[model samples]
Target: MSSVVDSTCEIREAQLALQRDGEELEHVEFTINSLYAEIEVIPKGNCLLQEKRHAVQSRIFTNSARISPVRSLPTEILQRIFKVCLPDDRYVTPDIRSVPLLLCQICRRWREVAEASSELWSSIAVYDLSDKGSYTAMVTRWLVASHHRPLAVSLSCRDAIIFHEFPLAPVLRWWSHTQHFITFVYTATISGLLD
Candidate 1:
């Protein structure tokens, strides 16, 4: 009789696990649908927007895998995986700690996946220096981003909403580093963006 009771409890646990998995599948389906839907919104004569989407999709996959063709992975990733790696910049680097923390916190497996993906950690996204100065703290993050691999930077503007802060040295270095890694630089100036 005790054995029969144990079997029933096991069956109930199995059902609960199955239900949770079904919910997870539903969430994944929604994400994919949204990505494709974004493509549908692409209008005519906007080749640049289309190209950006394609490139982003490609990066999403490449970074997730963690293995990059570079002689080394990016510095932001290194800073994340190897905490004591760069002692010089540790004191003032807000972006360095936050980028990986946010991505890894998305979920347990994603944290594991992001951790494994050195490429995902490679490139750093710089926030511009704003008039309000929310991004003053992110200087180290930019440095962390360009640390291991040559920098692939995106510069927003001289505007208040300076979305990125690319290191000048790495920019020059990456230009001479490799032809295979194409860096993209984007800008949305404050006057144009806010006005």
Candidate 2:
């Protein structure tokens, strides 16, 4: 019967498909086994490479023992060098690139030296004291840096009209306790400025 023939063809097609699937499965299994073998060897090679890198780093570190010529100097000599960096006869503006502050930024060693040198921070100048809050903070820092030493402060009144506008009471109170306080105020005329 034609039905029986159709069934026979269907059975043959199914068997061919099963054989194809079995071949594909075997190919997939081979690929997976190959990847597993590669993975097993990878850790050994990776560990060896890591060890080689660490050894090279150690050698580099040993060779770089004398990286900076300045580091060889004694602390006393270094402190003198830091002192020479400051302005000899001028006020240090609140600038980022100036001597004492810049020295602090150079490295930890320089920072310690600059910080320990109280004379470097003893001189302070106020070009404009309009901002009382900022002036307070700056004065506080200068006092701390002076380490109970005398302070040489210069106050410049840019505008006589705005002189009363500034907070002078707090400034007076802060500098009162200083042992040796030197204050210089530059003005064209002090006639009615206080009024």
Candidate 3:
């Protein structure tokens, strides 16, 4: 009878230990689940933080540009700066890659300043009169942009006949009325004749 009682007590103790271990396992599983939820949120939170940082940086850059020295320069001083940037060539070509046209392309304010500065458009060289139609229109626009400022026009052709064929109506009209000093340079290469 005493052996039976001892067996029963041992069995009860084993059951209690198992119950306690099961409760501890449940607590560990709960903790793991909570950690997984926090991990999932971290990436989303980090993305939001990054977006706000980018926005702030962009604003700082914009504000800094607004206070730049070049932006604050007077229009007259800016025009002088544009003049200084003009090409050393005898006459300005309508090439968009060069200074005066390049200056106009920078921004609206710069375009306004460059276009208004008549001196920037006062000189032009047309290297090809083969496309007389386009050249005439281009020359007329260039002269008009000069706002009656004295013009230095350079025309180059392979044949003198091309020069005669070029409609000089626009140039003549400007020359007839304006008292401003005008310089005209004509160049022709009559291959064998020059040699």
Kindly report which residue stretches of model 2 are placed more than 4 angstroms away from their true locations once superposed. 1-66, 132-139, 176-179, 182-195
Q: What lDDT does the true structure give each of the candidates? A: 0.53, 0.72, 0.78
1 or 3, greater by TM-score: 3
**Candidate 1, 184: how far from true, in Å?**
3.9
Model 2 has an lDDT value of 0.72
Write one digit per residue (lDDT tens) for candidate 1, span 1-195: 999999999999999999999999999999999988887766643787889889999999767755644325564554355443333431222343555545555545545545554454445444344423545434443344334554445544555433334444554463443333336565555564555
Which segments of candidate 1 are over 4 A away from where they belong?
1-99, 102-117, 131-134, 158-181, 190-195
By lDDT, the best candidate is 3
Over 126-159, each residue of candidate 3 has an lDDT whose tens digit, in order, gives 7765665855556555666676788787766666
TM-scores for all predictions: 0.27, 0.53, 0.55
- Identify the superior model by TM-score, candidate 2 or candidate 3: 3
> Residue by residue across 1-195, what tens digits does model 2's lDDT show?
999999999999999999999999999999999999999999999999999999999989766755867888888898788788777666665544776667777777788877788768867776665666765555566666677776677766567654655556655665666657654444423556666
In candidate 2, the residue pairs with backbone N, CA or C atoms under 3 Å apart (3 or more residues apart, or in different chains) clash, namely none
In model 3, the runs with Cα more than 4 Å from the true position are 1-64, 132-140, 159-181, 192-195
